[model samples]
Target: MKTHKEYLDLMLDGLENTKDKTPNSFSYDVLSAAGILFVEFARRFEELARKFDVDNLEGFELEKRVFQITGLKRKQATYARGLIKITGTVGTVIDEGKIFQTELGEEFRTLERAVIGDKGEIDVKVEALRIGPFGDVDKNTIKISKDYIKGIESVTNPADFTNGYGQESDDDLRERYYSYLQDPPKAGNPAHYRLWAEEVDGVGYAKVYRTWKGPSTVKVVIIDIERKGASSDLVEKVRKHIMEEAPIHWENLTVVSAKEKPIDVAGKIEVRNGYSKSEVIENIKEKITAYLAEVAFKKSYVSFAKVAHAILESEGLVDFDDLRINGTYDNIDLADEEVAVLGQVKLD
Candidate 1:
């Protein structure tokens, strides 16, 4: 870990004890050049050493290598799929591969061919071209088509896309790695089921219940990366994966999406002078949503105090009066198979 100057000084001191100690001497210049290379090598060695340590490892490939020793691979992102309504003249044929896009340029392709019905509209299933939350567009935002189609006058999504999930983050991957190391899954235990469920793409967290139905029955409840209920497709994927990995003797495995327990907030609040009430309320909602995500599947109950604190820490809040979470001041208890989701936020 010696610096270039320190290495050079050490070499110079050795030279002084033998021959010349003067600056700009032949040995001094040579040692200075060597010191620069030596320092570079030292820096590289430090970095190389860090790569061996799990806490300091960098880059996706390197982390993947470390985790792969135990058969854990980084989960890839998942595409969002939803229904898009197409409107045009009756009998207009919409090709199976027709493309539609949102204002943000996220593209979706029709999964099936459909013709406009007698009502001049038909709902066709579509899948996002790319993976991740970018495809999770709001309802009515997908109006643009990649290419104009005859009789394809308009298109819109009636509901928001909610199943989109991004690639697993480094932190989340690392946490999974550590969990595997700390609690080694073996012989189809609950931890094994939970780990297997989370390994599938789009699964954020999973809770495993043993003997829920009978002696040999196991149930897994999962939430998506957005901390919302897992879509039917995602649930099927997890179910398939667990079935493939589960022991042959283990029968009756159920993979289901976690039930969403909406948390509604309503209160009276005072906003700072420069900030509008609406802005402050929006910020509070964001903070509360983040808190809910943090506690999802981790805490058995939503802390009432934490919700109030999130509102109190809003960017433009001056003071607050009465605050209620689902019209109750007490912590909201969640069932084991439930995930807390943010609902309505009303503030005066």
Candidate 2:
């Protein structure tokens, strides 16, 4: 681990006892150049050592290779799917592959062809043209048709979109990799079922209940990447993956979305001098949401102290009084099949 300067100094000191102990000499410049090469070699050696350790590996491709030896792959991103209502003249043909978009230009395509009915409107299924959470739009947000149709008047989504998720992060993938090594899945055990459920894309966490109904019956409840309850489609995806991987006798396995436990926060707050009350409240909500996501499925109850800490961690907050979670200064217990989600932040 010797630095370039240190290596050069060593060479210079060794020459001090010899005949070539002079500054700006041929031998001195040669040794200095060699010192630089030595430093680079040392750096490369250190990086190589780190790559051999699973914990220190960097880059998506390198991490994938390390985990692939054990049959684990990074979960890919998922596309968002939803329904859009198209209104136009009756008998207007909406062909398959028609594109609709949001104000932000996120595109979605019709999955099937349909004609406007007698009511001059029809609901058609659509999938996001691209993967990731950007595809999940709010109700009535999709108003643009990429290609104008002759009789098309308007388009809108009646409900909020769901089930969109980004590709897994390196930290999250590493955690799962560690979980696989620490509690190796084996022989239809609870750990086995938990890992199986989590392997599906968009599933953030899974809780396994062994023998929930009777012997040989298991139930798995899962949440999505945002720490909210999994959509029914995501639940079915997990169910299908587990069934395909489980042994033939594992027909009693069940997969369901976790019930959402909304955590409503109401309090009085003193905002910092340069910050607006609305800004402070929004910051508090962000911190609280991150806290809830960090503890989902990992803790049995939401800590009252942790909730208060989240508020204190807000960037624009000066002080607070009478902070309440779910209208009480106490920890809220979560059921085994429940995941905590941010509800309302009512601040004065």
Candidate 3:
């Protein structure tokens, strides 16, 4: 897995190694030319390798070909949502797709047609045109596109706009492709429900349980891409998808978001003499976060031993004392619909 830069450095080292001992004619110009040639060739080789798989492909080619073969494509950019106040008479119409921009030039549009209110104040919502985490913006940052709308006093988000997600990553698409190939999604089986649940957008993980409520009852619990509880909208989307795909004879199906169970961590950390205690603590947090991500949807009990090991082995940490998860220093079990998330880490 050597990167292009690393390979280029190796080639340059070989050239230096071959410099004549007696003549010593390794001029800077010759070395610079060699470096440029190595870089050019390495980049071309990298491009050739990218063509080998859907995971490596990018841009339009990925959308047109690789994604088509895998049965999954990149997610398009999503819109940020917020409320806009319009001061106008009831007859006023805000057309769907009317554009707006933030002070930063991020564009947004109304989700649908809206009419003004009789009280001279109407609440309308808009979504950003561009996709990504950028769509999850703070309140009061949007202004109506000047030419289109008049008497627009101000825009404010009543709640956090967090539905925005970036295009699917190569790793994510690869997982879905492999899962589809492995199970191939047929009705009346747990695997079929799991596969269908995962196919929904924004779902990072899914698990299916038969007889969860009673005989002939199926429960599908899901976590979103951020490893948090799936939104109600997402839950409904999954439910509808399952309802349509499930066989007519199948029993009742319930799709629910995983409930978050926060766990607090407390410990006394000792860092080596040359290392900062804050840096060590931060590293411990990162390791714990990564551990949680890996075990979020599949396992019921998080390994307390693994968490202790992560903190003890952090790069700058010399040792830790009395490290406890929720004050017990033991593995905790979560119900089928519950997920564990880090809450607070107190280090002395």
What ordering of candidates by TM-score runs from best to worst?
Answer: 2, 1, 3
Query: CA lDDT, every prediction?
Result: 0.87, 0.89, 0.73
lDDT per residue, candidate 2, 136-239, as tens digits? 88999999999889999999999889978988777777788888888999998889998998888998989888888888899999999888999888988998
Per-residue lDDT of model 3, residues 139-177, tens digit only:
666654644565454444555566675566656666667
Tens digits of per-residue lDDT for model 1, 251-304: 588888999999999888988989998888889989999899989999999999
Point out where model 1 deviates above 4 Å: 12-19, 58-63, 85-91, 100-107, 116-123, 137-160, 248-251
State the TM-score for model 1: 0.84
Local error of candidate 2 at residue 253 (angstroms):
1.5
Best candidate (score: lDDT): 2
Model number with the top TM-score: 2
lDDT of 1: 0.87
Looking at model 2, report the run of 10 residues with the lowest lDDT sum: 57-66
